[model samples]
Target: MYCNHCGANQPDHAVFCSQCGAKLQTQSESTVPSEQEIDKEQTPVDYLDQLRSDQSSNHTDSEPTLPIANKPIHRAEPASSTVSVPPSGSPPYRSTSPARHLTWIIPTVLLLGIAGTLFWWYQHQQDINVQVTQLHQEASQLALKGQYEPALAKITQATTLRPTYAVLTKDQTMIETANRIHTKLETVSSNLKQNQLQPAEKSLITLQKALDTRKESIFEQEKTLANRNQDLLAVLKVKKELDQLDTIDALAYKLDEVDRLNNQEAKEVHQLIINKIITISMKNAEKLLQQNDFSQATAAVKAGLQYSSKDEKLLSLQKRITSEKEAFELAEKQRIERAIQQAEEEDLKNRTAGVELLNVDTQLNEYGDIEIYGEVKNVATKPIYSITVYYSGYDAAGNYLFSSSASVEPYDLEPGATGSYSAYEYDWYEEVTVQIDNITWYLE
Candidate 1:
């Protein structure tokens, strides 16, 4: 046998070519034996088969066996017509089958996939780098615009993307500037929270200076932003003072506002001082009034009224003083009137007396005796006249007689005049007594 692929000769009856490892085909002509060879090779099995063969088995026509030398041999094709095999020890040629090509395809696809993945990663890196640059630029712009919080956010993101960007020197400067600005803002914020207007203003000024310095150093346009922030802070402080003013008393509020204003800023400090003075004056006036010093109290209140003329309390105080003064004047007037009335009543109950007239005439003097002659007039007309003239007084019921006296003439003359005449001589009575009617007159 010969291999079709390799043309290697094989032994007869071989099922395969040994040299090329090809399968061999069986041939019937090669298996047939010649009749003489078969007769020479007959065995006892052929005689038994002839004797015991049934009619059916014999009729099946078993042909006589041929000798091996008479059998027709099947011959292989010529070597020139067979496929040639490679030389010994040479490796078999690989088939160009799709299944075999799939091995290279898998590796090629895997390589292509790896390349694509690397390319995608590179592109992603580039995109991220671009984004980082854009974010850094945006952050710088925002910082220049004085938007520190947002600028800080962008700067933080950019730093995360590119921890050490080559051009980050400027970005780093910007970040530092933003941090300084934030610190200044926080300082101002704390001062404002404490309601320290002066300190807060100072902080704002410092912040502006720092911002200006940063702008100049970095060649950024942040002065305008700094100025705007300062203006905003100023406005906020003014508004806060105004709001505080709303809740405080008028004098205190005005004083606080005046103090808050800058020295260069014109305000009504004088007016506030005057208002405070007026308030003090009013309080003093009230104190004086409470102490019952109306004269000084009125003066003080009048001074206060000069500033706050329409104050109800001042007016009420004035009214009260006027009422009190009027009451005092009325009481004094009543006291004087009562005193005059009492004096008049006392004068009406008093008693008064006076003498009308008396006349004395010719008389003789005697040893141990004296003559008396006189006319006595009655002055009181409220009673009747009783006549009794005595030089040495002796009555009609005389307990002792030293002399005698009789009325020569007597008359009752209304309340204007009444006359009587009498004479008496006596030594014992050196004085004379004359009684006209019921009125008595004594002459010494």
Candidate 2:
């Protein structure tokens, strides 16, 4: 028979063709082989094993011979038309069926897909690491700047990017530490403003422990708190001194002593001193007003007003001083006028009738002032309103030193009424002369 693969002539009973290494066609296969006839041929696995055995045998030694079966070989079925047999005398032909190639292609493609997937996952992990590192750096910088909230956000992002124990623990520690320091700083600031010195100091101490004191702003805050505490202490000391002081001068001196502190709190203390000074000055002014020392009272009020011109208490005190002074002056003027009128009436009575000094005397008192005293007798027909005794001082040699006058008591002296007259001169004189110079007489 002719070989079906290469059309070469072969023995009619040969199971495989020698020229093309293909199975020979038999009459039964050519007509239509039954299932039993098709099963008699090698399966695809056996075919592939034969190919591998032939390849190994070819490289080591002379080609190994195939096991030729004694039964008649059969032609492939029509369904295997796509299979192509190798040429005559070629090495054992491997299968060329489409299904055979698909097996290799599927495994190759699956292996390449797995390798590509692993490479992509590695790259993604690297990117996450880089992102997490960047977040950590940003968080650290923000914390240094005292931006605690933003820093915590960055740490949170980093932890989310890489949820490992290291990342989570680092984030928790960083955020808590920064937030704690920030809270303490806020507390310290509030306490300072409210004048809670002891609490502020304690908070400041806690903040300092967490912060780097070398920074200028942090150091400045620490110094400011310390100085504020010191200033308050000094103010309290001054207040204690002020409480012990009894005089306006001493209070004023104490106020001046605390003027060296110049902070905002110190400014408040200074204002307190000013208010106290105003209060003391006004109170003293009121006391002096009670004593009718209008000049001294005015001086006190004016002194207080100089420090605080717009103070209502000082203004009111000034108004009182002015009113009282004017009233005092008016009353004094009326009294002096009445005394002068009486003196004129007495002078007229003395001239019309007759008045004389019964005696004149002079002596030095303990105060080194001279006292010249005498008596007068009223000889007028009606009562006399008043009388004046004029006196002149002289040295032992009789040279006039000074001259003055005195009024007699019991100004409304009746006819034959005698009244006493006395006068004091602040001088060291040896002798004094007395005479009835004027008289004031009035009818009741």
Candidate 3:
């Protein structure tokens, strides 16, 4: 038999539990199905009779047992005599309580439930990690495409799923800042397009300040846009100034700044600037050329060529100027030569009329002026337009002291006609010797 309290093995007739030492109950003979006990349902009289029979047979010191709830139980005293044994084949007493069975059952159930809960928690965390990872990948892809809002949305979802991740938190902040800057850049661009210089400048300055002060890293595209807008502003200003100007000097002066931008707009502006310079230069040079101001024309062409050396119009104008200037110089040379030849031929044809200095005299007048007097003979047959005798005066030592000139009376003279002339030198020199050096006359 198993002990009821401790589940320890015991003999069939054990009066007390061996492991716990508690009083053990015997099985009621009537309770077991048997042929001998016919009064299975005992009346009150029979129960009383049996109790009196047990009381008369034994004198016991054991305490009376209390009745179970709503059931009457007969108590048996400890036997001093030998107890009767049941049949040898009868089953041993092995009753146990439901409460005892629940000890192991409840603990087993609790252990199983705890294990299930732990396993479920682990799987839940894994699922969360996977979700967060997928969200991060989506965010990254969107961010790469410059879709910051959707990317931020994904990151925000991830943040909600895994709020403890500091990396996610940082990513959220960075993306937020980048998106703000991007919006600001768009505003700046719109302002620039509308020619709102003040607002555009303010936006750019604010954006740059944010970039400078922000701890998170900004995107490269945002930085590039900012810088591009700055250059665009400067380029627009240059183009504005250039458009207002009509001179090559002003337009060409901004070419350097235009080149520095090196963007599409700047390249277009640069072409325009060069074209303006070339056009104005060509026109100015052409005007100067028409005026026969070759020097200034050459200067204008040179200025234009500085901007565009390969310009076809400027080159053509330059070539024309060269050709025209050369032709003019050649023509002038030929005319001068013709004039000299004609004058010489006339002089040779009229050589028969010779000039003579008859009654030539030089002396100091009483007014302290040195006087030179002479009579000129027109030794030519043709009448001269005007004749003047030029002479140099020297001292008695033959050193040049002064020079004098005089015109003969009766401006035109016939062949062999005589004319008298007198010249005075104001500066005093000792003992002057007058020598006639050259005479000039015009033959018209």
Candidate 4:
């Protein structure tokens, strides 16, 4: 039997636990009657009467014989007197406390439960690792296929399972990077397709910069593709700008800005641009010439000449503008000369009608000198205050004569006013005539 208090092994008849000094049983309670004593006993009533008679007889003694205490029990072999072996036919003593019976049983059940829990936990952890690994593999495959969204979802799930796992972490980063790159590429492609070159070029440049830090095989190829797309975008931009050009100056400016002429197509397009510019400039120049805007026409032609100085149409237009300008100048000069001539004729007529001589006489004076006199009048319906009279003397043969001049008496004349003039020439004698030469007069 096990000691109740300390669970130490002990004999069944032990009065006190050997390990903890706990009482196991009283001496009287531990003792069992011998089967021979039971057989020799009278009937049951007689035995009870005899056990009472003995107890009364023993109590009657002043000190009843102190019953000797039972001896300590042995571990394996014990004397029949020390051990409390029940009589051969008597039933064995059995414990009635449930707690006593369950002491060993409960621990065994607890141990089994703990072991089962540990095994299940290990299996669960293994399953989790496998699932995470499988998800990582799937994500890698999807990323390779360029299905980044689904791949990102898978990678996220795997990473959640093992946040500190190295392979999963790397895969997550790779997938995220690939997804970003794919997004940028799509944006660039869309912009390119829509002719949004500047934005597309910007995105491509950003993508190139991002790829510059990586050594991935695909990233390198993408970098190359980005560069090619950048070139293509530049070309397309140039071509678009060229297409929108409606004038030679604008096209020339755009051409100067473009740097991709080495491309065969760009070179051809450049040639076409030159031709178009020259043609448009020549046409504009022609229009300007027709409008008599010679300066603007010359400017337009020179603009075309800057692109193709030897182009036939431009040169022809330039020559035409020059010819037209020269012709125009000549016509203008002729017009001015005609105007001047007409003005001169009208002035001569006006002067002629302005003054006249009337009542003029010329004779030889007493000294045989020629004397001339006249009344000068402003015949222009205006007053006259001043006039000059001219006199000439000649022989009766009317040969060339000496001429002299004299002024009227006053210096100023009113409209239609008359002024007198007399001149005596003492040099020659003979016929004399008085004639009005010019009148200085003012209108009334």
TM-score of each: 0.29, 0.41, 0.57, 0.36
- The Cα local distance difference test for each model comes to 0.55, 0.68, 0.76, 0.69
- lDDT, candidate 1, 27-102, per-residue tens: 3333223344455553312322332333224333444332432455444334332233334433333232233344
Error of 3 at 386 (Å): 9.4
Task: Tell me the lDDT of candidate 2.
Answer: 0.68
Candidate 3: C-alpha lDDT:
0.76
- Candidates arranged by lDDT, highest first: 3, 4, 2, 1
lDDT by residue (32-134, candidate 3, tens digit) is: 3343343342421333445444443443345332233236555545343223444644554432434445545778799999999999999999999999999
Question: Considering every candidate listed, which one attains the maximal TM-score?
Answer: 3
lDDT of 1: 0.55
Worst 10 residues of 1 by lDDT: 346-355
Q: After superposition, how far is residue 198 of candidate 1 from its true place, in Å?
A: 7.9
Poorest 10 consecutive residues by lDDT, candidate 4:
65-74
The prediction achieving the highest lDDT against the true structure is 3
Better of 1 and 4 by lDDT: 4
Candidate with better lDDT, 1 vs 3: 3
lDDT of 4 by residue, 377-419 (tens): 6666445444666555556676656767788877766666677
Worst 10 residues of 2 by lDDT: 88-97
Better of 1 and 2 by TM-score: 2
lDDT string, candidate 2, 314-362, tens digits: 8988888899899989998998998888777766665665565678787
